[model samples]
Target: MLLAIDTATQAVTVAVHDGATVVAEHSTSDARRHTELLAPSIRDTLRAAGLRPRDLSAIAVGVGPGPFTGLRVGVVTARTMGLALGVPVHGVCSLDALAHGVMADGERTRFLVATDARRKEVYWAAYDVTDQGVRRSDGPDVARAADLPAHLRGLPTAGRGPLLYPDALPHALPQLDVGAGALATFAMGALRRGEELLEPQPLYLRRPDAVPQSERKPVSTA
Candidate 1:
Protein backbone atom coordinates (compact mmCIF):
# COMPACT_ATOMS: atom_id res chain seq x y z
CA MET A 1 0.00 0.00 0.00
CA LEU A 2 1.07 3.59 -0.61
CA LEU A 3 0.06 6.88 0.90
CA ALA A 4 0.15 9.90 -1.40
CA ILE A 5 -0.09 13.57 -0.54
CA ASP A 6 0.15 16.83 -2.45
CA THR A 7 -0.15 20.43 -1.21
CA ALA A 8 1.88 22.10 -3.90
CA THR A 9 -0.80 24.37 -5.22
CA GLN A 10 -4.23 25.51 -4.18
CA ALA A 11 -5.27 21.86 -4.19
CA VAL A 12 -4.79 19.68 -1.15
CA THR A 13 -4.88 15.97 -2.09
CA VAL A 14 -4.44 12.83 -0.08
CA ALA A 15 -4.87 9.21 -1.10
CA VAL A 16 -4.20 5.62 -0.20
CA HIS A 17 -3.16 3.43 -3.12
CA ASP A 18 -3.48 -0.33 -3.21
CA GLY A 19 -1.34 -1.23 -6.17
CA ALA A 20 -2.55 0.74 -9.20
CA THR A 21 -5.97 1.32 -7.75
CA VAL A 22 -6.68 4.28 -5.52
CA VAL A 23 -8.52 2.83 -2.58
CA ALA A 24 -9.49 6.14 -1.02
CA GLU A 25 -8.70 9.77 -1.79
CA HIS A 26 -9.70 13.26 -0.76
CA SER A 27 -8.97 16.63 -2.27
CA THR A 28 -9.92 20.28 -1.72
CA SER A 29 -8.86 23.44 -3.49
CA ASP A 30 -8.47 26.00 -0.78
CA ALA A 31 -5.17 27.84 -1.02
CA ARG A 32 -5.33 29.25 2.48
CA ARG A 33 -6.07 26.08 4.43
CA HIS A 34 -3.34 23.61 3.55
CA THR A 35 -2.01 23.22 7.07
CA GLU A 36 -5.40 22.88 8.70
CA LEU A 37 -6.87 20.61 6.04
CA LEU A 38 -4.00 18.26 5.15
CA ALA A 39 -3.74 16.17 8.32
CA PRO A 40 -7.47 15.59 8.64
CA SER A 41 -7.75 14.64 5.00
CA ILE A 42 -4.92 12.11 5.33
CA ARG A 43 -6.51 10.63 8.39
CA ASP A 44 -9.86 10.36 6.63
CA THR A 45 -8.38 8.75 3.54
CA LEU A 46 -6.51 6.15 5.55
CA ARG A 47 -9.58 5.39 7.57
CA ALA A 48 -11.70 5.04 4.45
CA ALA A 49 -9.12 2.71 2.97
CA GLY A 50 -9.16 0.62 6.15
CA LEU A 51 -5.48 1.00 6.70
CA ARG A 52 -3.19 2.38 9.37
CA PRO A 53 0.16 4.15 9.12
CA ARG A 54 2.09 0.89 9.54
CA ASP A 55 0.28 -0.58 6.56
CA LEU A 56 1.76 1.97 4.23
CA SER A 57 4.71 0.39 2.44
CA ALA A 58 5.92 3.76 1.27
CA ILE A 59 4.98 7.42 1.18
CA ALA A 60 4.87 9.47 -1.99
CA VAL A 61 4.65 13.25 -1.81
CA GLY A 62 4.62 16.15 -4.23
CA VAL A 63 7.74 18.25 -3.84
CA GLY A 64 6.67 21.34 -5.62
CA PRO A 65 7.40 24.49 -7.49
CA GLY A 66 4.93 26.17 -5.18
CA PRO A 67 4.60 28.80 -2.55
CA PHE A 68 7.11 28.20 0.22
CA THR A 69 4.77 27.59 3.13
CA GLY A 70 2.22 25.43 1.30
CA LEU A 71 4.94 23.27 -0.26
CA ARG A 72 6.70 22.74 3.07
CA VAL A 73 3.64 21.35 4.79
CA GLY A 74 3.37 18.33 2.49
CA VAL A 75 7.08 17.56 2.40
CA VAL A 76 7.46 17.80 6.15
CA THR A 77 4.44 15.58 6.74
CA ALA A 78 5.81 12.91 4.41
CA ARG A 79 9.21 13.03 6.05
CA THR A 80 7.80 12.81 9.55
CA MET A 81 5.48 9.98 8.58
CA GLY A 82 8.28 8.06 6.95
CA LEU A 83 10.33 8.33 10.10
CA ALA A 84 7.44 7.24 12.29
CA LEU A 85 6.39 4.36 10.06
CA GLY A 86 9.91 3.33 9.10
CA VAL A 87 9.06 3.34 5.40
CA PRO A 88 10.76 4.90 2.44
CA VAL A 89 9.61 8.31 1.24
CA HIS A 90 9.47 9.25 -2.41
CA GLY A 91 9.33 12.75 -3.79
CA VAL A 92 7.73 13.55 -7.12
CA CYS A 93 7.46 16.63 -9.27
CA SER A 94 4.05 18.21 -8.79
CA LEU A 95 4.09 19.12 -12.48
CA ASP A 96 4.32 15.43 -13.36
CA ALA A 97 1.10 14.85 -11.47
CA LEU A 98 -0.66 17.50 -13.52
CA ALA A 99 0.74 15.94 -16.68
CA HIS A 100 -0.40 12.47 -15.64
CA GLY A 101 -3.91 13.77 -14.97
CA VAL A 102 -4.11 14.98 -18.56
CA MET A 103 -2.35 11.97 -20.08
CA ALA A 104 -4.90 9.68 -18.45
CA ASP A 105 -7.48 11.27 -20.73
CA GLY A 106 -5.47 10.38 -23.87
CA GLU A 107 -4.91 13.95 -24.87
CA ARG A 108 -2.35 15.24 -27.36
CA THR A 109 1.04 13.55 -27.41
CA ARG A 110 2.77 16.76 -26.47
CA PHE A 111 1.71 19.55 -24.16
CA LEU A 112 2.89 21.94 -21.51
CA VAL A 113 2.54 21.41 -17.76
CA ALA A 114 2.31 24.49 -15.62
CA THR A 115 1.32 25.65 -12.14
CA ASP A 116 0.93 28.99 -10.44
CA ALA A 117 4.07 30.45 -8.89
CA ARG A 118 2.16 33.39 -7.38
CA ARG A 119 4.39 36.23 -8.44
CA LYS A 120 2.82 36.82 -11.81
CA GLU A 121 5.02 33.91 -12.95
CA VAL A 122 4.49 30.24 -13.64
CA TYR A 123 6.39 27.03 -13.03
CA TRP A 124 6.18 25.34 -16.42
CA ALA A 125 7.39 22.13 -18.01
CA ALA A 126 6.78 20.25 -21.26
CA TYR A 127 5.69 16.65 -21.44
CA ASP A 128 5.50 13.97 -24.08
CA VAL A 129 2.73 11.53 -23.38
CA THR A 130 3.53 7.97 -24.38
CA ASP A 131 2.25 4.45 -23.86
CA GLN A 132 4.70 3.90 -21.05
CA GLY A 133 3.71 7.15 -19.30
CA VAL A 134 4.30 10.87 -19.39
CA ARG A 135 7.90 11.92 -20.05
CA ARG A 136 9.17 15.41 -19.36
CA SER A 137 10.93 16.83 -22.41
CA ASP A 138 11.62 20.42 -21.50
CA GLY A 139 11.43 23.00 -18.78
CA PRO A 140 10.34 23.14 -15.21
CA ASP A 141 11.20 26.80 -15.56
CA VAL A 142 9.78 29.79 -13.75
CA ALA A 143 8.93 32.77 -15.93
CA ARG A 144 6.53 35.66 -16.08
CA ALA A 145 3.28 34.55 -17.72
CA ALA A 146 3.71 36.94 -20.60
CA ASP A 147 7.38 36.05 -21.01
CA LEU A 148 6.94 32.33 -21.68
CA PRO A 149 9.07 31.06 -24.52
CA ALA A 150 7.45 31.91 -27.87
CA HIS A 151 7.37 28.25 -28.87
CA LEU A 152 5.18 27.32 -25.92
CA ARG A 153 2.61 30.02 -26.67
CA GLY A 154 0.11 27.90 -28.60
CA LEU A 155 0.68 24.40 -27.30
CA PRO A 156 -1.88 22.59 -25.21
CA THR A 157 -1.39 23.49 -21.56
CA ALA A 158 -2.70 22.25 -18.22
CA GLY A 159 -2.62 23.46 -14.59
CA ARG A 160 -3.63 26.67 -12.89
CA GLY A 161 -1.12 28.74 -14.84
CA PRO A 162 -3.32 28.75 -17.91
CA LEU A 163 -6.29 29.81 -15.86
CA LEU A 164 -4.20 32.68 -14.51
CA TYR A 165 -2.87 33.77 -17.89
CA PRO A 166 -5.52 32.93 -20.41
CA ASP A 167 -4.26 34.85 -23.41
CA ALA A 168 -0.69 33.70 -23.00
CA LEU A 169 -1.74 30.10 -23.58
CA PRO A 170 -4.86 29.90 -25.71
CA HIS A 171 -4.91 26.11 -26.06
CA ALA A 172 -5.39 25.39 -22.41
CA LEU A 173 -6.84 22.06 -21.33
CA PRO A 174 -9.55 21.43 -18.77
CA GLN A 175 -7.76 19.08 -16.36
CA LEU A 176 -5.97 21.74 -14.40
CA ASP A 177 -5.60 20.00 -11.05
CA VAL A 178 -3.24 17.14 -10.24
CA GLY A 179 -4.65 14.44 -8.05
CA ALA A 180 -2.74 12.53 -5.37
CA GLY A 181 -3.57 9.31 -7.22
CA ALA A 182 -1.37 10.38 -10.11
CA LEU A 183 1.48 11.06 -7.70
CA ALA A 184 1.07 7.59 -6.24
CA THR A 185 0.86 5.98 -9.67
CA PHE A 186 4.01 7.66 -10.86
CA ALA A 187 5.92 6.73 -7.73
CA MET A 188 4.66 3.13 -7.83
CA GLY A 189 5.87 2.63 -11.39
CA ALA A 190 9.33 3.81 -10.50
CA LEU A 191 9.44 1.66 -7.38
CA ARG A 192 8.22 -1.41 -9.31
CA ARG A 193 10.95 -0.88 -11.87
CA GLY A 194 13.61 -0.41 -9.17
CA GLU A 195 14.36 3.02 -10.62
CA GLU A 196 15.64 5.79 -8.41
CA LEU A 197 12.91 8.10 -7.22
CA LEU A 198 13.44 11.82 -7.37
CA GLU A 199 15.38 12.96 -4.32
CA PRO A 200 13.11 13.91 -1.47
CA GLN A 201 13.54 17.63 -1.94
CA PRO A 202 11.17 20.52 -2.55
CA LEU A 203 11.47 22.00 -6.04
CA TYR A 204 10.91 25.58 -5.05
CA LEU A 205 12.03 27.16 -8.36
CA ARG A 206 12.57 30.55 -6.79
CA ARG A 207 13.72 31.81 -3.41
CA PRO A 208 10.96 32.12 -0.87
CA ASP A 209 9.13 35.35 -0.18
CA ALA A 210 10.51 35.51 3.35
CA VAL A 211 14.20 36.16 3.82
CA PRO A 212 16.35 36.12 6.92
CA GLN A 213 17.47 39.45 8.30
CA SER A 214 20.97 38.01 8.68
CA GLU A 215 21.24 37.80 4.87
CA ARG A 216 20.76 41.53 4.57
CA LYS A 217 23.87 43.66 4.53
CA PRO A 218 23.97 46.05 7.49
CA VAL A 219 23.88 49.80 6.80
CA SER A 220 27.44 50.99 6.45
CA THR A 221 28.60 54.03 8.39
CA ALA A 222 29.04 56.86 5.88
Candidate 2:
Protein backbone atom coordinates (compact mmCIF):
# COMPACT_ATOMS: atom_id res chain seq x y z
CA MET A 1 0.00 0.00 0.00
CA LEU A 2 1.09 3.60 -0.63
CA LEU A 3 0.04 6.37 1.72
CA ALA A 4 -0.06 9.91 0.36
CA ILE A 5 -0.64 13.38 1.78
CA ASP A 6 -0.98 16.82 0.20
CA THR A 7 -1.00 19.91 2.44
CA ALA A 8 0.14 22.05 -0.41
CA THR A 9 -2.79 24.44 -0.31
CA GLN A 10 -5.64 25.23 2.05
CA ALA A 11 -6.62 21.61 1.52
CA VAL A 12 -5.27 18.79 3.66
CA THR A 13 -5.69 15.50 1.84
CA VAL A 14 -4.65 11.92 2.51
CA ALA A 15 -5.01 8.70 0.56
CA VAL A 16 -4.08 5.04 0.51
CA HIS A 17 -3.29 3.50 -2.87
CA ASP A 18 -2.85 -0.17 -3.54
CA GLY A 19 -0.65 0.18 -6.58
CA ALA A 20 -2.36 2.35 -9.22
CA THR A 21 -5.82 2.10 -7.69
CA VAL A 22 -6.84 4.13 -4.68
CA VAL A 23 -8.32 2.07 -1.88
CA ALA A 24 -9.23 5.03 0.31
CA GLU A 25 -8.92 8.82 0.41
CA HIS A 26 -9.75 11.82 2.60
CA SER A 27 -9.37 15.59 2.21
CA THR A 28 -10.52 18.82 3.83
CA SER A 29 -10.30 22.57 3.28
CA ASP A 30 -9.13 23.18 6.81
CA ALA A 31 -6.19 25.50 6.17
CA ARG A 32 -5.30 26.41 9.72
CA ARG A 33 -5.41 22.97 11.27
CA HIS A 34 -3.08 20.92 9.09
CA THR A 35 -0.82 20.13 12.02
CA GLU A 36 -3.73 18.92 14.09
CA LEU A 37 -5.77 17.20 11.39
CA LEU A 38 -3.10 15.36 9.37
CA ALA A 39 -2.34 12.48 11.71
CA PRO A 40 -5.86 11.60 12.71
CA SER A 41 -6.99 11.77 9.11
CA ILE A 42 -4.22 9.42 8.05
CA ARG A 43 -5.20 6.96 10.74
CA ASP A 44 -8.83 7.16 9.77
CA THR A 45 -8.16 6.64 6.10
CA LEU A 46 -5.97 3.63 6.77
CA ARG A 47 -8.54 2.23 9.13
CA ALA A 48 -11.25 2.73 6.54
CA ALA A 49 -9.07 0.78 4.15
CA GLY A 50 -8.26 -1.79 6.86
CA LEU A 51 -4.52 -1.20 6.81
CA ARG A 52 -1.74 -0.09 9.16
CA PRO A 53 1.24 2.21 8.87
CA ARG A 54 3.58 -0.75 8.72
CA ASP A 55 1.43 -2.25 6.01
CA LEU A 56 2.42 0.58 3.73
CA SER A 57 5.28 -0.06 1.36
CA ALA A 58 6.01 3.66 1.03
CA ILE A 59 4.81 7.13 1.99
CA ALA A 60 4.25 9.77 -0.67
CA VAL A 61 3.94 13.47 0.07
CA GLY A 62 3.41 16.63 -1.90
CA VAL A 63 6.63 18.59 -1.80
CA GLY A 64 5.03 21.94 -2.18
CA PRO A 65 5.07 25.38 -3.61
CA GLY A 66 2.84 26.53 -0.78
CA PRO A 67 2.63 28.36 2.51
CA PHE A 68 5.40 27.35 4.89
CA THR A 69 3.38 26.09 7.84
CA GLY A 70 0.88 23.77 6.15
CA LEU A 71 3.48 22.48 3.69
CA ARG A 72 5.78 21.58 6.56
CA VAL A 73 3.00 19.78 8.37
CA GLY A 74 2.48 17.26 5.57
CA VAL A 75 6.16 16.81 4.74
CA VAL A 76 7.18 16.36 8.36
CA THR A 77 4.33 13.96 9.03
CA ALA A 78 5.25 11.84 6.03
CA ARG A 79 8.90 11.81 7.03
CA THR A 80 8.10 10.78 10.59
CA MET A 81 5.86 7.97 9.41
CA GLY A 82 8.43 6.78 6.90
CA LEU A 83 11.12 6.65 9.59
CA ALA A 84 8.92 4.83 12.05
CA LEU A 85 7.82 2.25 9.53
CA GLY A 86 11.27 1.88 7.91
CA VAL A 87 9.81 2.47 4.48
CA PRO A 88 10.88 4.97 1.88
CA VAL A 89 9.22 8.40 1.58
CA HIS A 90 8.74 9.82 -1.89
CA GLY A 91 7.76 13.26 -3.23
CA VAL A 92 5.78 14.51 -6.17
CA CYS A 93 5.59 18.12 -7.30
CA SER A 94 2.23 19.20 -5.90
CA LEU A 95 1.28 20.93 -9.16
CA ASP A 96 2.25 17.92 -11.27
CA ALA A 97 -0.06 15.81 -9.20
CA LEU A 98 -2.79 18.37 -9.80
CA ALA A 99 -2.22 18.09 -13.53
CA HIS A 100 -2.25 14.31 -13.37
CA GLY A 101 -5.67 14.46 -11.79
CA VAL A 102 -7.23 15.94 -14.95
CA MET A 103 -4.96 15.17 -17.86
CA ALA A 104 -6.02 12.61 -20.44
CA ASP A 105 -3.88 10.09 -22.33
CA GLY A 106 -2.42 10.87 -25.78
CA GLU A 107 -3.32 14.53 -25.58
CA ARG A 108 -0.51 16.74 -26.72
CA THR A 109 -1.02 19.93 -24.81
CA ARG A 110 0.90 22.52 -22.86
CA PHE A 111 -0.24 23.67 -19.42
CA LEU A 112 0.55 26.14 -16.74
CA VAL A 113 -0.04 25.12 -13.12
CA ALA A 114 -0.37 27.88 -10.60
CA THR A 115 -1.26 27.93 -6.91
CA ASP A 116 -2.17 30.81 -4.65
CA ALA A 117 0.87 32.05 -2.72
CA ARG A 118 -1.16 34.58 -0.72
CA ARG A 119 0.66 37.87 -1.29
CA LYS A 120 -0.86 38.88 -4.62
CA GLU A 121 1.84 36.70 -6.14
CA VAL A 122 1.49 33.09 -7.20
CA TYR A 123 3.63 29.96 -7.43
CA TRP A 124 3.58 29.06 -11.11
CA ALA A 125 4.96 26.44 -13.46
CA ALA A 126 4.45 25.41 -17.09
CA TYR A 127 4.11 21.83 -18.28
CA ASP A 128 3.73 19.76 -21.43
CA VAL A 129 1.73 16.56 -21.22
CA THR A 130 2.90 13.72 -23.39
CA ASP A 131 2.47 9.95 -23.69
CA GLN A 132 5.03 9.48 -20.93
CA GLY A 133 3.33 11.91 -18.53
CA VAL A 134 3.40 15.62 -17.64
CA ARG A 135 6.74 17.30 -18.04
CA ARG A 136 7.51 20.68 -16.48
CA SER A 137 8.48 23.31 -19.05
CA ASP A 138 8.60 26.44 -16.89
CA GLY A 139 8.86 27.44 -13.31
CA PRO A 140 7.96 26.85 -9.70
CA ASP A 141 8.42 30.59 -9.15
CA VAL A 142 6.64 33.36 -7.27
CA ALA A 143 5.47 36.06 -9.63
CA ARG A 144 2.48 38.13 -10.62
CA ALA A 145 0.36 35.86 -12.83
CA ALA A 146 0.31 38.56 -15.50
CA ASP A 147 4.04 38.08 -15.70
CA LEU A 148 3.72 34.48 -16.86
CA PRO A 149 5.48 33.79 -20.15
CA ALA A 150 3.68 34.79 -23.32
CA HIS A 151 4.15 31.29 -24.68
CA LEU A 152 1.81 29.97 -21.99
CA ARG A 153 -1.18 32.04 -23.15
CA GLY A 154 -2.64 29.43 -25.52
CA LEU A 155 -2.27 26.42 -23.21
CA PRO A 156 -4.91 25.13 -20.82
CA THR A 157 -4.23 26.20 -17.26
CA ALA A 158 -5.38 24.90 -13.88
CA GLY A 159 -5.09 25.30 -10.09
CA ARG A 160 -5.94 27.87 -7.38
CA GLY A 161 -3.45 30.45 -8.53
CA PRO A 162 -5.31 31.05 -11.74
CA LEU A 163 -8.46 31.86 -9.88
CA LEU A 164 -6.47 34.05 -7.55
CA TYR A 165 -5.03 35.90 -10.54
CA PRO A 166 -7.65 35.67 -13.24
CA ASP A 167 -6.22 38.68 -15.06
CA ALA A 168 -2.95 36.85 -15.51
CA LEU A 169 -4.57 33.84 -17.08
CA PRO A 170 -7.59 35.29 -18.84
CA HIS A 171 -8.05 32.44 -21.32
CA ALA A 172 -7.02 29.45 -19.20
CA LEU A 173 -9.15 26.54 -18.15
CA PRO A 174 -11.21 26.75 -15.01
CA GLN A 175 -9.38 25.66 -11.88
CA LEU A 176 -10.08 22.32 -10.21
CA ASP A 177 -9.22 20.72 -6.91
CA VAL A 178 -6.19 18.48 -6.94
CA GLY A 179 -6.99 15.82 -4.41
CA ALA A 180 -5.06 13.17 -2.43
CA GLY A 181 -5.89 10.34 -4.83
CA ALA A 182 -3.84 12.07 -7.52
CA LEU A 183 -0.86 12.34 -5.23
CA ALA A 184 -1.06 8.66 -4.34
CA THR A 185 -1.46 7.63 -7.95
CA PHE A 186 1.64 9.52 -9.05
CA ALA A 187 3.65 8.13 -6.17
CA MET A 188 2.60 4.57 -6.94
CA GLY A 189 3.98 4.96 -10.44
CA ALA A 190 7.30 6.11 -8.99
CA LEU A 191 7.45 3.16 -6.59
CA ARG A 192 6.69 0.66 -9.35
CA ARG A 193 9.61 2.01 -11.39
CA GLY A 194 12.04 1.68 -8.44
CA GLU A 195 12.69 5.41 -8.12
CA GLU A 196 14.84 6.57 -5.23
CA LEU A 197 13.09 7.84 -2.15
CA LEU A 198 13.04 11.60 -1.58
CA GLU A 199 13.35 13.47 1.66
CA PRO A 200 10.51 15.91 2.28
CA GLN A 201 11.38 19.55 1.61
CA PRO A 202 9.46 22.73 0.89
CA LEU A 203 9.65 24.01 -2.67
CA TYR A 204 9.75 27.66 -1.67
CA LEU A 205 9.98 29.67 -4.85
CA ARG A 206 10.95 32.82 -2.98
CA ARG A 207 11.94 34.02 0.49
CA PRO A 208 9.52 33.50 3.35
CA ASP A 209 7.18 36.17 4.66
CA ALA A 210 9.15 36.89 7.80
CA VAL A 211 12.50 38.61 8.13
CA PRO A 212 14.69 38.30 11.22
CA GLN A 213 14.46 41.22 13.63
CA SER A 214 18.18 41.79 13.42
CA GLU A 215 17.89 42.27 9.69
CA ARG A 216 15.34 45.06 10.02
CA LYS A 217 16.77 48.51 9.46
CA PRO A 218 16.36 51.10 12.23
CA VAL A 219 13.87 53.89 11.54
CA SER A 220 15.39 57.37 11.12
CA THR A 221 14.91 59.58 14.20
CA ALA A 222 15.54 62.94 12.52
Model 2 Cα displacement at 31 (Å)? 2.3
**In candidate 1, which residue ranges exceed 4 Å CA deviation?**
214-222
lDDT of each: 0.88, 0.80
lDDT of 2 at 210: 82
The most accurate candidate by TM-score is 1
Clashing pairs in 1: none
Q: Provide the global lDDT of candidate 2 against the true structure.
A: 0.80
lDDT of 1 by residue, 28-60 (tens): 999999999999999999999999888899999
TM-score of each: 0.94, 0.89
